[model samples]
Target: MKTLTLDLSGIYTAVTPQSIQAWEEKSNQYQQQLHAGTGLGNDFLGWINLPCEISEEQLSSIEEAARGLQERCDYVVSIGIGGSYLGARAVIEALTPSFEAYQTKHTAPQVIFAGHNIGEDYLSELVAFLRDKRFGLINISKSGTTTEPAIAFRILKALLEEQVGREEARERIIAVTDKARGALRTLADKEGYKTFIIPDDIGGRFSVLTPVGLLPIAVAGFDIRELVRGAREMKALVDESVPFAENPSALYAAARNSLYQAGKKIEILGNFHPRLHYIGEWWKQLYGESEGKDHKGIFNASVDFSADLHSMGQWIQEGERSIFETIVSIAEPNTTLRIESDEANLDGLNYLAGKRVDEVNKMAELGVRVAHIDGGVPNIRIVLPKLDAYYIGQLFYFFEKAVGISGYMLEVNPFNQPGVEAYKKNMFALLEKPGFEAETEAIKARLK
Candidate 1:
């Protein structure tokens, strides 16, 4: 099976070979720290070997639970914020047809997401839409108290119970949360909802190989075993024993950090395939949250090419030289689509009549890379053999491993997100939630 590969040739001009070699040494130390559990976020290093560590029994259990959900529901609402839903959504969107929701036929339940936002109209419309459809809820949170998802689950729970009655609704809900504690775990235990434990050491962003991501992808009818196998294969290829030059993950970490050191602060993850848009979303969260700390790290951004070419192309091509791009290149599209010859040739597209659509896309991609490089942007390309469960799995692990090494290169603790609580504290204070009386008063005074 072909795997995902990273090419840093395009970035060589912007980041010298010597710089990459130096960063590779640093990345090696970081990789060692990760394996030895001696790094800043050592406690969260559970994800370091997660791909290889997942057992067959666990995979079976996850599939079994997903099968139950699939047998019962027409739609499955995966509810979580950030890593919780992003990974699952990324895999599902990449594998499923773009118009699968509108299609009359589908083998698997159509998976949708909620609890990632607090949009009033979004939640209202979701509830209204679920009124007639048979839907199951996959509520994911370490704590059941994350405001957005908590509110969504509350409303959805009530509606589901009213629609199907309490007993059946309990059976339809699956809670993926902490094993020993957390409000969600407690509720799952008490109400007898199917449950999966999110490993205590794995943070949300790195939990894709865990039940957090696998179950949803499985529920959507993708091959979870192949996904896990692909991740495991990548785990072996990027192991500490693999040389820095040969390890794609290490090279990626080294190249990106080298670019950052050279004053390129923004990393744009650009993809030509639209299905990969959410993969970009997931990548942003993975790198942004993991590396963006202590007033440092690259600004992670993304754009879908050919489409965003018309929108953000100008800025990316001629914007500040601080920006660099990493493009995800798909080597082969899944389906064949030829541009047929037109007799009239009025629109003047006849020159490319016999070519496949993907051929044109590849040219556009190559053209953009050359143009962007000329206009002062460095480019990194990650080539996937094809878009499938296995390659996507390989891609996920590649980024996850690279981010860990990259974050350590930036001298920050990637696992813990201390900055995320700043807004939560203010929101809770302004809302006068229970124990924040002093903060509430202080915030009110500041507001006045």
Candidate 2:
């Protein structure tokens, strides 16, 4: 029953508790703005109550679609970028076995991702790998015209059709896109592919709870119901009515802003557990895109611990003092392994004999905290009771809610990513896309 909790004790050295507490009134005001649909990006606030709004029928439909994919394909490629695919991939990677690729058997189709980038070799290798495999596609895009996923869908759709024949391939592809418009929606309607609606009010990064994330997660054989339940619980806990003192999201938003004001410009999300790697990636996108605007947001970064302890640890310990760390600490691991007494003790790890591996990890995490704090870097700790579908759900919602408040505190539109299109226009012009003829001519002149 214990859910995600945030501890700001590690941050007290850098910014006083009173400074963080001062954000209480402002944070609550922002939370109210989100609820009342009065904020700058209020039109895209559908995700605020999404968990509670999702009816039983919707969950069942997604589950049914997932069941079909599970039954038909040995591998399922989830094609999209940013929020579209990060949420599902984060959850699946957290729950999946570390060495799943080497596993001899699987009860559900292995889910893979694509279209996040335009790497030719990556696509080529993916095509060659899937040539002989029983695979399917879940194409996610609201516009179905995003350059990366659109190109990927084109290539993969042809491959799947060739392998399974066009008629059967239609059944293998599911489209999560706009309800009534967009290229993907048009294609799905024409081709008769099973379709799910990506809500108009919900932006891509926040679309995880919708069919955009649910269908792929369910297909991965995880419990979507539990995940939604956890998010609903968090939604209630972080509601504007809750006292700021007891609200995890409010405190997190406040603490982060407090540090940012105190000259800590970079937040490095660190985790001791390896399975949670994508969670960091997802968190980075959530915070970075939501808050990194108006030239006034903290830089979000991440590191995988114990492993990065060797690589990034030195820099963190003695590098520039502008960075602080927020560590996601898991209290309990899914499995257990204890160190055993070795007769030779050749590695000198005998001192750890009879201790659970988690114990050493915990000690190392504590040691790092003390070292970092002493090294003048503030830290924030997010404790999850266990890593499961429910906790992951809670974690995702916690960050989502906090980032909304944080962005508001920083005076930026949390939901809109206007700067993301600058590169696209240039890329299209360089490629001589018809509509960009003027831009193409200008760019060619500039190059000369």
lDDT of 1 at 384: 94
The per-model lDDT (C-alpha) reads 0.92, 0.94
User: Candidate 2: global Cα-lDDT?
Assistant: 0.94
| TM-score per candidate, chains pooled | 0.99, 0.99
- Candidate 1, clashing residue pairs? none
Which lDDT tens digits does candidate 2 get at residues 64-147? 999998989999999999999899999999989899879889989999899999999999999999997999999999999999
TM-score of 1: 0.99
lDDT of 1: 0.92
In terms of TM-score, how similar is model 2 to the real structure? Answer: 0.99
Candidate 1 residue lDDT tens string, 337-377: 99999999999999999999999999999999999988889
